[model samples]
Target: MFRATTATIHTLCMLALAGCQPSSDGRDHGQMQLDACVAEACTTLNLDGYGMRDYNAVAGLAHVTSLMVSYTDFADLSELAAMSQLRELHMGMTEVTDLDGLAAFPNLEVLHAQYLEPQSFAPVAGLARLRELAVGSAGLDDLSFVAQMPALHRLLVVNSVQGLDLSPLAGHPGLRALDLRASDGMDLRPLLTLPNLQEVALSRIGEDIDPTQAQVVAQLRARGVSVDLDAIVVPVC
Candidate 1:
C-alpha cells in the first residue's frame, strides 16, 4: 500500500511538470503583439490626411512607446488612450480637437502638434512628465495653460496666433528654448522676463516693436539669449 501511494504522488508530480512546460509554438503575449504592430505602423505611416482607417487597423495594438500620426485626417483621436507607454507623440496637421486622453500616458515626454488649434492642447496639461512641446502654426490666442506644465523645458509657439501675452511663461523656470516667429503685433516685453530662457526666435515683427524693443533684444543677446531677427520684415517707424 505504501509503495502504491508513493507511485500515485510521483505520477501527479510528473503531470504537473508536464503542464508547466512551455508551448512549442512560442506564441507571444497579447501586449507584445500589440507593441509590435504599433511600432511597425509608426515606422511606415505617412501623414498626408485623415488616417482613421489606418489607426483603426492598429488601434487594438496599443503598447507603442512613440506614435507619430502627422498630416492624417483623423478627427477624433480618443482611441490613443490605449497607448499607455507612449513617450513621444507627434500629431501634426491632424484635426484632433480634444486631447483629454493624453493624460493617461504617464511617461509622455515630447509632444509636437503643429498646425493644430489652441483648444487641442488643453488635455496635455495633465501630463506630469511632459518635457518638450512644439505647437507652431496652431493659431493659439492664450498661453495661460503653459504655466501649469511644471516639467516643460522647450516650447515653440510660432506663427498663426495673435494678441498673446507671454507673461504667464515667466513661471516656467525650466524653459530653455522659445519660438515666436510670425507673431505680428505682439509685445516682446513679457518674453524678456523669462529667467532661464536661452534661445528665442522672433520672426515677423509688427508695428508694435520699436527701437527700444530692439535694444532690449540686443541686451538679451548680450545676456546669452540667441535672438533671431531675420523675420523682422518692416522696421517699426
Candidate 2:
C-alpha cells in the first residue's frame, strides 16, 4: 500500500514538471498574432483623438516617423527614446516644461514647440540634423545658444520675448527666413548683417523704439532686407 501511494505522488510531480516546460509552439503562435495586429494598426493609425493615455500603446512601435502630440497633458516624453526613427515631433500646447529626453532622436528634423519657456529649448541645441524650428509665444529672452546649431534654416520668434539680440545668427549660411514680430525691445540692426538672409518679418517695431525709430528702419531697408512695418490704428469715430 505504501509503495503504491509513493508511485501516485511521483506521477503527479512528473505531470506538474511537464506543464512547466516552455513551449515554443505556443510562443510562436502568440508572436505571430501580435505581429499581425501591429502591422494592421501602423498602416491605419488615427492619431487625432488619442491622448497621453494611449502613448504607451504606440511606444513599442519602432516604424513610426511623424508624431503629433499637441494638446495632450503629457509633461515629459522619456518614453520617446525607444523610437529611433522619429523625424518630426510636435508638442505644442502641452504641459511639457523640459526637453531633456529629446537627445535620443538623432534623425529629428522639424520641431514645433510653441508657447514654452526659455529653458525648454535647451535640449534642442543637441539635435545636429534639425532644419526648421518654430517657437513662438514662449518667454524666450536669449537666443545665444542657437549659434551652435549649424543646420538651422527657418526660425520664427514672435509676440513673446521682451528683448532679443540676434547677433549670434551672423555667419549661418543656411538661414533663409527669420520672423521677429511684436518683440518689445528687439533691435533689427544685428539681423541685417546676416549674409544669406532672404525673407524677414520685422513687424511692430515702433512699440519699443524712440523718436529716431524711422532712421533705424531706413538702415534695415538699405541693407537689402525686407521689413514689414506693423502700424497701430487708433479709432477717431
Candidate 3:
C-alpha cells in the first residue's frame, strides 16, 4: 500500500491495480482523432477502453489523489497541472511528449510508465518526493537522471541497457531494491556504496563477469546484501 493513499498500491498504479480494459494494441490516434479519447479517459477513472466520445470531463473527484490514463494521445498535458493533490500516476503507452506537466504534482510519490522515452525523465528530475519508478522500454542507455530523485527507494527497469554505468546510484541513501535483469553487463561496483541497499536481482543475463565484479559481489555478500543471481528476477511490480 502507498503512504499517500491507503487505496493505492506501491508498484501497480490505477490501471493495473484496478480492473480496467486497456487500449487495444496497434491503435494509432493522430492529433485530432485522439483528444476525445484522452478527455474521456482522464475525466472518468475508468478508461476501460478507447473510443471517440463527446464529453471532455475533468477528474472531478474530491481528493484527486491517484489516476491512470493509458493508450491515449495527449500532445499537450496542460490539463493535468490542475490536479494539485495527485500523488501517483500511471502513464500507459502514451504518445505524449510533454512530460514536464508531471512536475505540477509535487505530492507525487510513485510513477509507473508502460513506455520510457528520452526526454520523458527530465520533467521529474526536481520532484524530490518521488519514491518508486518503474518504466519499460527498449532504448534507455542514460539513466543518470535517477540520481536527482532524493526519495527514490525502488527502481525497476524491465528493458535492456547494455553496458550501463550504475555508478550514478552511489550514495543514494533511500535506494533499497534494484531489479535490472533486462540490462546486461552492468557495473556492480557503484551499488556497493549505497548504505541502505538491501536486495539486488540480476537474472537471465549471460555470464560475462570479470574479476572486478566478482570481487564486488563477494564484498556485498560479506556485508549481508541479498543477491538473487539466478531467477526470473523482478521488483515489487
Q: Compose the digit string of candidate 2's lDDT tens values, residues 125-226.
A: 898888877665547766765788877887766446676666778777667677665445666656656677766665552355554445656776787756
Off by over 4 Å in 1: 1-52, 118-120, 136-139, 205-209, 231-237
Question: What is the RMSD, in Å, between candidate 3 and the native fold over all Cα?
Answer: 7.7
**What range of 10 consecutive residues in model 1 has the weakest lDDT sum?**
1-10
lDDT of each: 0.61, 0.60, 0.61
Candidate 3 ranges beyond 4 A from true positions:
1-56, 71-76, 118-120, 205-214, 230-237
The alpha-carbon lDDT assigned to residue 226 of candidate 1 equals 80
Clash count of each predicted structure:
6, 0, 0
Task: Give lDDT: candidate 2, residue 24.
Answer: 45
Give the TM-score comparing model 3 with the true structure, all chains together.
Answer: 0.70
Q: Give the higher-TM-score candidate: 2 or 3.
A: 3
Return the candidate ranking by TM-score, descending. 1, 3, 2
Shift of residue 197 alpha carbon in model 1, Å? 1.1
**Candidate 2 weakest lDDT stretch, 10 residues:** 1-10
How well does candidate 2 match the true structure in TM-score terms? Answer: 0.68
- Can you list the residue pairs that collide in candidate 3? none
